[model samples]
Target: MMRRRLLYWITALGLGTLILASTGYAQTLSQQVLNLLARTNTWTADQTFDNLTITGVCTGCGGAGGGTVTSVAMTVAPAAIFDIGGTPIVGAGTLALSLDTQANNLAFMGPNGGGPSVPA
Candidate 1:
């Protein structure tokens, strides 16, 4: 009886760890948007959000200053979102904004190909 109980406890503990490793705490949509904005070589971060939708301007992406950001947003995650003055480089034929908070950095590929921006 004792051996059986010990085995059950061990199995339960392992299962719990598996679940945590798989599904971490949820990320707000706004935060994800801000991350996309900061990566641009041109645009400066006007605002940040948790949702996928973003609104920003581009005045110093790479040029002296000529871009304007009246508003920025997308119905869904766009292929890419560059800074106010940044150029949107297409990766893997498209752009995809993804986020992973697994303590390890997430790969924010333009579409779908590459490793994490940071090792985390």
Candidate 2:
């Protein structure tokens, strides 16, 4: 009986470890998006700057008398938002932004080899 109990405990521990180990391979949607962005460099960071001025300080940059100060304002594009557990639903090779795995179990509802359509 003692040996059987030990075997049961070992089996339980092994199963628990296996379950936890399997989860490590599965990445969250946000993590996947971040990894993709880092690799692809497709998105640009958002930035805002105002009243920026530069003055010469180097020996060859010339003295303050010869330097000029300029004011400028700039804005950069914002990054894309990655919704949690978000998955794309494509139909006829077109993405249906309005459809998701949660809302629609089957994302592809059109006939196979059908013509392309505009993505949502």
Highest lDDT model number: 1
Off-target runs (Cα >4 Å) in candidate 2 are 1-65, 79-120
Q: Residue by residue across 1-117, what tens digits does model 1's lDDT show? A: 455432111101111111111233323334433345345434332333332222333222345568645443333333243222222433323334443233356454565575567
Per-residue lDDT, model 1, residue 59, is 21
- Per-candidate total of colliding backbone pairs: 26, 0
Residue 56 alpha-carbon offset, candidate 2, angstroms: 24
CA-only RMSD, every prediction: 28.3, 28.9
lDDT of each: 0.32, 0.28
Worst 10 residues of 1 by lDDT: 7-16
What are the models' TM-scores?
0.12, 0.12
Query: Model 2, residue 80: what's the lDDT?
Result: 26
What lDDT tens digits, residue by residue, belong to model 2 across residues 1-120?
Answer: 355432111101111111112223322234334335335333223211232111211112223576543433222322122122222322323222332234435353668679888999
